[model samples]
Target: MIEYDSYGRMKYDPQLHFNQGKTWVDEDIDYLIHWLEIIGYEEMSLALGRTEATVRDKVFKLRKKGLMKEGDKSKRHRKLLGRCKDEQAVNY
Candidate 1:
């Protein structure tokens, strides 16, 4: 259940929070992955009102910690795409 403003916008409903002074929660990671699958990472970042890198980092960290099973290929693909864009940008 997501909270929505009167204008049909999602409100600032944070599923993730710092516990005992700044710690990542598994549930939060799971939630993010779930949404990422549905909306993609960029839109998930927008919906979370966070930067794209932040969201990507969270996924990466979780994968490193074994808190996530997916995203390995996605991460690789993103990096490859980034490199391609950078090369293209330089040539242009």
Candidate 2:
């Protein structure tokens, strides 16, 4: 079940987003990097059990560290459309 704020926006729920505010493990980071290149933020968030904001923030940090390239929305869109080959298997 989901709860909403007074403004009708979804409220943050610990039960739904259990990893919120938790330290990211190395495995999680690896998974995030791999999937991030192929999926959009919302899909990545749901797969990682994290909020979209948190996922975006982490992606920012990873890019800052030279760990990831700038995400190309068009590339991801192509992948979603099955136009690109699945180069890597999705672990999560």
Which candidate comes out best when scored by lDDT? 2
Which candidate gets the maximum TM-score versus the true structure? Answer: 2
Judge candidate 2 at residue 32 and give its lDDT: 90
Tens digits of per-residue lDDT for model 1, 1-92: 33333433333334421121245456656678676766666456555555455676788877788866674344421321122322322111
TM-score of each: 0.46, 0.66
The lDDT values for all models are 0.50, 0.66
Q: How accurate locally is residue 89 in candidate 2, as Cα lDDT from 0 to 100?
A: 23
lDDT of 2 by residue, 1-72 (tens): 454334333335575567888899999899998887777765676677777678888999999999988877
Q: What's the C-alpha lDDT at position 90 in model 2?
A: 25
Stretches off by above 4 angstroms in model 2 are: 1-11, 75-92
Quote the lDDT for 52 in model 1. 53
Q: Model 2, 70: alpha-carbon shift in Å? A: 1.1
